[model samples]
Target: MKLEPVIGLEIHVQLKTKSKMFCGCSNRGEFEAPNATICPVCTGQPGVLPVINKEAIKMGVLASLALNCKINEHSKFDRKHYFYPDLPKGYQISQFDLPVGEKGFLEIDVPTKEGIRTARVGITRLHMEEDAAKNTHSDDKTATLVDYNRGGTPLAEIVSEPDIKSPQEAKIFLQELRKIMRYLGVSDADMEKGQLRCDANISMREYVEGAAPDENWAIQLNPKTEIKNINSFRAVERALEYEIARQTKHWEETGSPNTVQATRGWDDTKGVTTEQRTKEGSSDYRYFPEPDLPPMELVEIRDKQKEMLPELPRARKYRFMDQYGFSMADAEILTDDPYKAEYTERALSELVSWLLSLPEIEGTETEIWDNYGEKMAKLYSGWFINKLGGIMAQNAIDIRILKITPENFAEFITLVYENKISGPNALKLLELMIGAGGDPSQLLDEHDLGAMKEDKDEMDKIIEKVINEHQVAVSDYKAGKQTAIMFLIGQVMKESKGKANPETAKEMLIEKLEK
Candidate 1:
């Protein structure tokens, strides 16, 4: 029978705030000691209370807005009861019935086995939660030590419906979500750094042949197993694929025995998942309101956040096309990286005003990458993203980090446009000037790489020497050989130590040979 897979994602996004969710402890990217950043409140000490971080709530709201979610005016936190070594309080403070955001949808275009498929992935809810402590298990697990430093770190959990029909679709949705978060600067979404985590609840369904039964065999969905701790994107894809097959095999083997609803651990090294324990439901945790913390009140910060909000990806793309005469393709490439796009806007400077005034320039700035003026547009775009970007990453460096400012680059472009410098020569000079910050005018003063004027008396002498030295090539030129000119040009460059104006050398040679 043909099979279909049903999938949903429960993604946890770590808020990039300076402190913990309910405490003032620092959340360092990397740390040196165990429980160094933890305090009485976050550690769940008796008689202590949690104070919600205002910034964390605002960050969550901004992400919710970006995802097209409805912000819940009133919401409360509930304790998710569980027992593990990492949990100091035997439960995690998380939202259950009412979350911070709800009823959102994000459209994603994913590729299936057949072709490109667009699906509206429904979001059930987005809630705020505190992270669990880190457990280090290795050669040095003396006394089962735990690092509470990461505990109470604010995390936004986005829950999606089981609209995904395959593992590939789930992965695509994840990647799209990651890119959106990065664009908004809301979170780094770096899975490797434990910034983002996801748990999937997948089941299989029939094609609904004949009629939809009260409950088909497939609809029973064998015990929705929870696969745990997938760290990488590829790992997410692999774990889901493994789980679906494992569960399907279990059902097919023993006449579809009723499988247990249990937790499973993913052994990434072995590429197999093993059952951990029975998965807990809502009542298992004994959730209730915390007396220490008040209901989170979102102060109307629209005025401030709206101002802090930079140009979003789509708006930036439109500006690139409407304002800069960039083709849609160019605009897309330019807007793909937020920092690079910001840099491009800075580089264009007042040229943006000129482009805005002209009708012809209006069509130039589009997000479509149709190769419209592909070469020239790409030159500037690539340099901003690729060349200069590496330099800026070290210590808040700028485009002038390469020693060639936008004005200097513009001046160099002017020289090439005026034909004062040849195209090939200008590129060569740019590479040097960008690194050594050398003067373009003085570049060939001692080098002799430019064209020699015929009006000069010294030009006649150099021409005489070149003609006498390259007799074989001279004979070939006179005999109607076209390549002979290139051969003689190489010779001139060699003898002049790359300091001869190739154009003048060619013209002088041709004139002298004709006589």
Candidate 2:
């Protein structure tokens, strides 16, 4: 019998706020000394009362709305009792029955062999909670150290339903979710820094070929193995894939699915999931409503957060495609980072305005945009995403600190579009501008890199020199070897020291060769 993997994810996002969730201690303690941000409330001293972070609550509401979750008007904290070194109070303050949001869905674009398809994954809940302290174990396995600096940090736990069918879908879902968080200014969602973490619950079920699972699929689901220690989205995908294969092999060997639910840890270096412990049910935590903290009234909070919502990634992506004529792939890359997206829009706006003001270009604003918007957009994206992006990567420059302003970038792109400078000279001018910002037109003149096309006499002299120097290629072109003209054009460009425009040189070479 063939088996299909059923998967769910538990994502914990560290909220970007001023202080810890229930205390006034600093929240920026990840890079600080151990226990530097700890206080009585966060470290669980005797008789310390917990106060909720209003900013954290506001961010939670914003994220919930972005995820299309229904916010609970009445929600309160609960005490989750579990004994661990990381838990100083012996219980964690989290939401139980009354979470901040629930019954939400996130749409992910899944790539298939044929094409891309949208898949909606159901969200079970997004609850507010406090993070545990950091734990460091000795290499000898004889001692363990706990750092309370990260303790009591605000966290939003997002639990997804078992709607994910494959590992690739799970990875895409996480990436989209992270983009939403970053767009909302809720969290950085950097997986390597532990700002965003994931745990996967996966199980294998026997299924018929070419048939969808029915409502009774849950009843038929074999006991799931909860895989933890998934530090990154790639790890989440790899762990789920490994667990599915392991469970499928067990089913084959034992003639039945594994009956016991368990927990496993992913060893990224080894590319394997090692058994950690048996999974615990909800009752094991002994959850109860906290007595100190009062229940929240969210009607006012929801309204305020809704007003503060910015344009999300998906909407921005569609707008880029419809308005700028950018392809889906290019739009996705452009909108992935909010800062980068804003920069692109501003630069494009400048370019469009400049294009419309040119005296030689004939047409109304709408007609001009319709005629040249796509062509200009393609040129801009190629230079921005491919050329400039590669240069930034090489020099370790973030878009935030980029020396080239959007206006300057727009000017540079216009230079390329108008062919004011040759392609090679344009690249050199761009690198110069990126290092020490300046106007593209002025820089072109300052560097003596203007295209030779405007100098018709000089271009004619260079073309004539190339035809005379490459007699064999000239003879080849005259004798019906039309491809030899490309060689002649290369000689013209080289003879002109990369100042000659290739198109003009090709036209001049063909004109002279035909004569």
Candidate 3:
């Protein structure tokens, strides 16, 4: 029988607030010594009342807005009963009935057989919670160690609906979620650092071979296997793919079993899922309102957070395409990182201002501003995404640490736009500006990398010298050999100490040689 995979994700994002969720302990425990940043509240000492971090709540609301979730004005915390070495209180304080946000959606582009298609994944809830401590077992399995430093860390648990149909879609959804969180400045969402973690609930069902089933039957889904604590997006995709095959085989052999849902852990090294325990239902947690802390009034907070939100990635991407005429692919690349997007915009703005201020020596100022947006978009995207981006990748330098200011980069681009420098010379000047942090024009002059002899008289003299030196090539060019003209142009550029613009020299050579 044909098979269809049903998948959803539960993502825990660590808020980048200064302190823990319910305690004042520092949240920078990832780099500190084991258990160095712990406190009584975090470690769940006797009779210590927990206070909510106002900043964490604000961040959560901001994240909710970014995810397109509806804010719950009165969300209360509940105690989730569980027993584990990582749990100090034997119960985690989280939201049950009332979460901060609900009914949101994230759209991701998936590579389908046809082409790239956009899939909108639904978010069920976005809840605030505290993280459990770390557990490490020894090599001999004789001793287990627990670190409480990460306990009580503020986390926003985003639960998605079963709208994800394939492993690839799931991965893209998570990646988009990470990008949104990062853009919001609420979370770094770095899986390697445990800032963002994912758990996937996946199952397989029959394709319903013939006639449409009844409403009740259509709503029926097979038993789901929850894969716990997948650290990376790729791992989530791999694990889900494996589970779909495994469950499909099992269903073929024994058919769908009506039993308890299973929770399994992914062994990334072995590339398999091991049964951890039966998945617990909501009733199993026995959640109730926390007696210590009162429910929050977040209506005003939500309004404030919505106002504080900067332009998100998707909106900014569409704006780039619509307003600046960037292609979808180019806009995606530019907006993938917040800093790079910001840099691109700043550089474009400065370039436009500079372009409009030009003396109109060659072109009309009206013409420059009329199509300046599209012109600047292409120019900035080409150089920044390809040329400068490639250089940074080769040198392993972060864009944030780049020495060239956006204004200086705009000026450098102007030099190229005006054909004041040759490509090779412009690249040389760019390297100097990036490395030494100086004005592009000044550096160009200091390095003598500009087109040599801007005066037409001087250029004509140099071209005449080249034509005289390469008489055979000049004669060949005059006899209708186009290749010989390029040869003469090369000689002129070399004689000009690599400063002669190839285009200018070629034009000058063609004029003199044709005459």
Strongest candidate by TM-score: 2
Overall local distance difference test of candidate 1: 0.71
Scanning candidate 3 in windows of ten residues, the lowest lDDT window is 210-219
* Poorly placed runs, candidate 3 (over 4 Å): 111-116, 208-218, 255-260, 361-375, 453-515
In angstroms, give how far residue 460 of model 3 lies from its true place.
9.7
Residue 373, candidate 1: alpha-carbon lDDT: 32
Write down the TM-score for model 2: 0.94
Per residue, candidate 3 scores C-alpha lDDT tens digits across 1-515 of: 68788898999999999999998899999889999999989998998999999999999889988888999999999999999999999999999999999999888877768977878888999999999999999999999999998899999999999888889898888888888998999888999989999999987776766645343235567778899868898999999999998888887888673256999999999999999989899999999999888999999999999889998888888888876679888998999889888987888788767876766533555466556667767877888888888899999988889999988998899888877787777877878887988899888888877876577888888887877677898778778888997788778777777777888888777777667
lDDT of 2 by residue, 20-77 (tens): 9999999999979998989999999998999999999999888888888999999999
Model 2 lDDT, full chain set: 0.91
Q: lDDT scores for all predictions? A: 0.71, 0.91, 0.86
Predictions ranked by lDDT, top down? 2, 3, 1
Clashes of each: 22, 0, 0
Model 1 C-alpha lDDT per residue in residues 106-142, reported as the tens digit of each score: 7766655796566788888888899999888778655
Give residue 138's error in model 2 in angstroms: 2.5
Pairs in clash, predicted candidate 3:
none
